[model samples]
Target: MVTIKDVAKVTGVSPSTVSRVIADNPRISPATKKKVREAMEHLGYHTNIHARNLVAKSTKAIGVIMPSSADKALQNPFFPEVLRGIGSVIHERQYSLTLSSGETEQEILAEVQRMVYGSYVDGVILLYSRVDDPVMSFLQERDFPFVMVGKPFEKLQEITHVDNDNFTAGKQITNYLIASGHEKIAFIGGSKDLFVTRDRESGYQSALTDAGLPNNDAYKIHTEFLKSGGREAVERLLSLPVRPTAIVVTDDLMSLGVLSTLEESGVQVPRDISLVSFNNAYLSEITRPALTTVDIHIHELGAQSARALIERTVDKTVPSRRIIVPYNIIYRNSVSEQ
Candidate 1:
């Protein structure tokens, strides 16, 4: 088995120098580094990350905590797109990524604990934020280096988070509906437990208030982020007396189900009921009528969270950061004038 010692001997440098070269210590001269690396390649000396981690106290890896099980979360295109963004930065930094996805909150917390206690990764990126989240509490109590992709339930000044201005986004999109002559507008969102949904919903209500439109409680529906959730929300809305003229859905995935269900019920999109959604997922563009939605820049959110967490891991004393990625509206055929 090739070892650092063999490379050191061939390169005529001490084993310590070989180790330093492996660590890419800036103190080592570039010429010496080049020579050592050439010898390492020639001798087939591959680094054992386990040993290196033991010495440096770093795994050179980051853990990504998904909000739900992989099978369920990946059904929404948002997850894949965000992961691609995170992966881009991770790859550029020459770091590895570990995804921790569990079926429930408890299971997810357990996976996070393992990642931290077992020294599996240098830091973690939480993909979702919940009110009074045990996972967030655990990371806080341990003073573990981590970042969230959504607003924290509390301690906004202390926890590092990357998110869009969802409140403003919601209001802007809702205002667009109102300007298009939609007086009776309804809202469909994910679980109220998520701050994203709550903030967006708040903005939606605010828009209605400003426009002097009644913010009817019956017009608001909360469900899961899946297409099935959209389908379910549509069923409820359809049952309402004097149905809304337009709807604002919090997720593109849910909007897909909403469109399908509305069609199945013999309701034509735009012609009968207009819809606007969040997250300009790829499918949004290919749908029959396409979709008028908010482009929350899901990829940028992931990239920023990973970058922030990496910075925190490198220097634990660095102050927490709040990164707000900008968002814009993607106009499509889903919305029409009432």
Candidate 2:
């Protein structure tokens, strides 16, 4: 095995310099670091990560905590896009990412405990935030370095997070429909346990209240974050004694489900009932009538979370912070005048 000492001897640099280069210590000048890396490559010297971690007391790896329903959650496609953004940053920083998730909250909690207690990761990136989440509580109690990808339900000052302004997003989309003469508009969202759902619901309600439009309980529905959930919501909405003129779905996958249900029922979208959704994901453009949805910059959400987590791992004293990515509504054929 070509050791660090051998590489240092070949490069005429000290062993300490070689170690610092491997650690990517910023104090080392760029040119010297390049030279050290080149010498290591020439000598076929590979640093044993385990041994280095043992000596440094750092794993050089991060844990990614997904939602409890991870298998179902990943079906939405937004998660993958967000991860691409995160991976772009961390991969170059010499940090590896490991994922932990489960079908239930307790299962997810168990996975997180193992990762945190086993010293398997230096930090964690949480993919979702929910009300009274045990995983969040556990990380907080342990003073672990972690970053959330969504707004927390509370604790405005302590947790570091990256998210879009969901409240304004919901209000803006609702106001758009109202401007288009959609008075009997409806809202469909994920479980109320999620802060994303709560924020968006508040925005929607605020928009309706400002416009003097009726915010009826009959028009608001909550269900799973899945296609079937969207379909069920549409069914319930259409069956109401007073049908809505338009609908605001919280997710693109749910919107896709809504479109499918409408097509099967011979209900022409935009013509029959204008529709809008969030997370302008891949399917938004290809739907029979491209969805006029909100693009919350999912990629930036991921990239920024990774950046924030990396910042946390480097300095514990850095005050916890918040990063809000921008959002926009893309006009497509799915939404039309009432």
Candidate 3:
């Protein structure tokens, strides 16, 4: 119930000065700002966020629109790590985080519209990037500021995004499999429309070609980045007349599914088939054979996204909008010299 008026009275500053101090306006003299802050802390005065937002025309809140599939968001360690990174930066700036999940494109778009138009958030961070996404298009059309965690296939020049070089990560994994003496390698990846999948697939093909190995379409399977999808892709690959000696899965969760199916089939890992995966999630380390994976720095990715969004919200003139995090490969027991 403590209001800015009480802080102003205690600090002997005008209500407007107290308000400016609360807003962290640079115009307020440092002495006045310090006194106002001390009074606020002493009196336990918290500004009404809604009222402050209305007065300043900024929410000091950021909207994070994640995939509608709750299971995907919960099961994947990458998302949590990314969120952690974002939270770290946002908390430092005293900004609140609001998360919204949508199952369909339409639902997501509607939610985004509401957030942008209703002044619920100053900006948004989208976790997934698809080719020609309606959400991206809508935001772009209105000139609403937003950032994507993954790169979109189109509009590479138009929007700000943060992502690791997925194509390089894919190629590196593929090369690791090849160096282990595996010629027949299969790919189990995420949705085809997603830019991550496209980039990784390109990397896979590039690695094969560079190594003088034929890029066989039969060995490639595009599925959801889930355990079920991984299991199905592995099963299909195993059923092929020319089975793959190794597999490069785009997601760690999907790699777990591949492992499960392989174990159920009585196939020994690394001895019979080697595997590599992305994300380097905890599941990779705990599996029967610790998975070899590419560490895409998920937490750092999230943190960077948050920082970028905050910067855009604070100052529209800050340059160097696009940020690309780096990736590293973790060699594990899942792969051996074949």
Winning model by lDDT: 1
Q: Which residue ranges in model 2 land beyond 4 Å of their true spot?
A: 1-54
How well does candidate 3 match the true structure, expressed as C-alpha RMSD? 6.5
Which parts of model 1 are misplaced by more than 4 Å? 1-54
Superposed Cα RMSD, model 1: 6.9
lDDT of 1 by residue, 63-118 (tens): 99888999999999989999999998889778899987798999999999999899
Candidate 3, clashing residue pairs?
68-102, 85-303
Model 1 lowest lDDT segment of ten: 45-54
Q: Please report the TM-score between candidate 2 and the true structure.
A: 0.85
> Candidate 3 residues 1-338, lDDT tens each?
67767777888887766756654554578988888888887887655545555666988899998865555576777777788888998888889998877778898899999998898998899998997789889988887778899996677777789998999989988998998899999999988998888999899899999999987899999987778888899889989998888999999999989999999998889889999999888788999899999998888888888877776665554443568999999988988787
> Where's the lowest-lDDT run of ten residues in candidate 2?
45-54
TM-score for all predictions? 0.85, 0.85, 0.84
Cα misplacement distance, residue 136 of candidate 3 (Å): 0.5
CA lDDT scores, all candidates in order: 0.90, 0.87, 0.84
